[model samples]
Target chain A: GAGVSQSPSNKVTEKGKDVELRCDPISGHTALYWYRQSLGQGLEFLIYFQGNSAPDKSGLPSDRFSAERTGGSVSTLTIQRTQQEDSAVYLCASSPNPVYEQYFGPGTRLTVT
Target chain B: AQRVTQPEKLLSVFKGAPVELKCNYSYSGSPELFWYVQYSRQRLQLLLRHISRESIKGFTADLNKGETSFHLKKPFAQEEDSAMYYCALKGFGNEKLTFGTGTRLTIIP
Candidate 1:
């Protein structure tokens, strides 16, 4: 079966710019999550979506970060006015349900110069 | 707030030697503990979960509520085991996970 997939394996952008990272979850997954990995922060949860319910944005670092999952399948994480601190690997994962194991994608490595 | 801690930032062990990667967590309620591993150039993947009580790739972890810990252990380490290991915790019914900083395990062959 096809696992989770992410686009733009690597991205380099200047500060103050905006970038969008994409994610495609498994066919029947109902839960999608975005996480960030960095040298200093390890892995930090960003947001999560479960079915048609409200998305959990508690872990988002700031207002500049946002994400949307459409049709319960694909998700996109957008960072506005990017900062150097945002340079890290953006990861996406999906699970069949709340209690199932999450499958992760290759991730998009973002660099802010 | 829920939190996971991997005390050691790095661990090194020789082939065939015993290895232990310590992990501790803090949470207000019942927590689901998990070990995630990432090999070089590979995406993070689940290594094992405390609830499963099953070993993966010769690795096993036991949840100790009294100590608030779930340490991963392997009787015999292998070179292939070298990777970054992250300990994570999810509160009951919570979709988000609190992750540790991670431990880079280096298997000396």
Candidate 2:
């Protein structure tokens, strides 16, 4: 079966610009999640969606960061007014449910200059 | 708040040697524990979960509530075991995972 897939494997943008990262979860998976990975921060959870509704956005660093899932399959993470600190690899994962093992995507490496 | 801690930022061991990667977490209630591994050039993937009590690739972890620990161990390390390991925790039911700082294990051939 095809695993989770992410788009724009790498992105470079200027400060204050906005960027959108896309994620396509595996077929029939009901749970999707976004996370960020960096040098000093390791990996940080950004948001989680269950059937197109985000229940927990606590990990979002700021209001400028938002995510949305549609059709319970595709998700997009948008970072508005990006900063250099926002430079990192954005990862997406999908699971059968919250308790099941998650399958990960290759991730989008965003660079903010 | 829930927190997962991997004390060792990096670990190196010789092939066939015993290995232990420590992971400790602090949470107010019962939480689910997991270990994630990312091999070079590969996406991160689950290595094991405390709830399953199953070993993967010759590695095992035991969750201890008394000490708040879930250390991953392998009796004989292999060269292919080298990778970045992350310890994660989540509240039971629907909850996001909180990950550790991660430990980069380098198995010497």
Candidate 3:
């Protein structure tokens, strides 16, 4: 079975720019999540989607961060007006349901200069 | 606020030695605890969960509610056991996990 896959494994952008990271979850997973891993901060949850709608976006650091899932499959995380502090590995994970074990993607390493 | 803490940032142990990666979490309600591991160049994956009570790769974690801890332990550490370990907690029915700071375990050959 194919696992979760993320595109653009690495991205480098200047400050104030915007970037979009894509995530393709497992074939039948109904839940998807995004997280950021930065030095010392560990892995910080960003947003989660149950089906096509996100029930929890509280973890999103600011309005500059947003996500959308279409057709109940592919998801995209967009960071607008990126800052140097945003340099981190953006990870995507998918689960069979709301309570199943999660399978993660390789993650997109985003560098904001 | 839910929080997970891995007290040691790094731990080193010789092969065949017992190993323990300490993890403590703070949450208001009963939570499901899990241990996740990431080998070099690999994506993070689940190692074990308190609910399953199953050991993976000779490692186990026990969730202690009274102490709010879920420490991962292995009786005999192997060189291949070296990796970054993260302790996570999930609210009942809420799949989102709060991960610990992580511990880098080095098993010397």
Candidate 4:
């Protein structure tokens, strides 16, 4: 079975520019999550979506960060006016439920130059 | 706020030697604890979860509520075990995983 997938394995953007990262969750997965991994720091939770319930946006670092899940299958994380601090590997994961084993995709690395 | 902690940023052990990776967490409720691993050039994957109480590839962790720790251990370290290990926790209602800074393990043959 196909696991989760993400687009644009690598991206280099200028500061203050905007970037969009895409994620395709495993089929029939009811839960999707986004995280960021930076050097020295661990994976930071960004956002989460489950079924049709309102997405949990608590982890978004700032107002510039946003994400949306369409048709409950794919999700896109957008960063507007990105900063140097936003440079990191963005990871997406999916699971059958909130407590189930999460399958992770090969993250998209974003570098703010 | 719930949080996970992995004290060691890096660890190295000889092959066939006993191995232990420390992990501690802080959460008010009974949290779901998990250990995730990522090998070189491979995507992150679930290694084990406390609730399952099952060992994966000879690795096991016992959740100690009194100590607020869920440290992963293996009787004999294998070269393939060398990778990054992360400790994570999910609170009952939060449902979002809180991860700790990962520990990179290297097995010396």
| TM-scores, all models, native as reference | 0.98, 0.97, 0.98, 0.99
For DockQ, the strongest prediction is 4
Q: Enumerate the candidates' DockQ scores in order.
A: 0.83, 0.79, 0.86, 0.91
Error of 3 at B73 (Å): 0.5
DockQ of 3: 0.86
Name the regions of candidate 2 deviating beyond 4 angstroms.
A52-54
lDDT: which candidate is best?
4
Native-referenced DockQ of model 1: 0.83
Where does candidate 4 clash, by residue pair? Answer: none
lDDT of 1 by residue, B47-80 (tens): 9998899989999999999999999999999999
Each prediction's Cα RMSD?
0.7, 1.0, 0.9, 0.6
Candidate 4 lDDT by residue in tens digits, A1-113: 99999998999999999999999999999999999999889999999999999999999999999999999999999999989999999999999998788899999999999
Estimate the TM-score for candidate 1. 0.98
Error at A76, model 4, angstroms? 0.5
TM-score of chain A of each: 0.98, 0.96, 0.96, 0.98
True contacts kept of 4: 0.91
Better by TM-score, candidate 3 or 1: 1
Classify candidate 1 by CAPRI docking class.
Answer: high
| Poorest 10 consecutive residues by lDDT, candidate 4 chain A | A94-103
Report the lDDT tens digits of candidate 3 across residue range A8-107: 9999999999999999999989999999999787899999999756458989999999999999899999999999999999999999987889999999
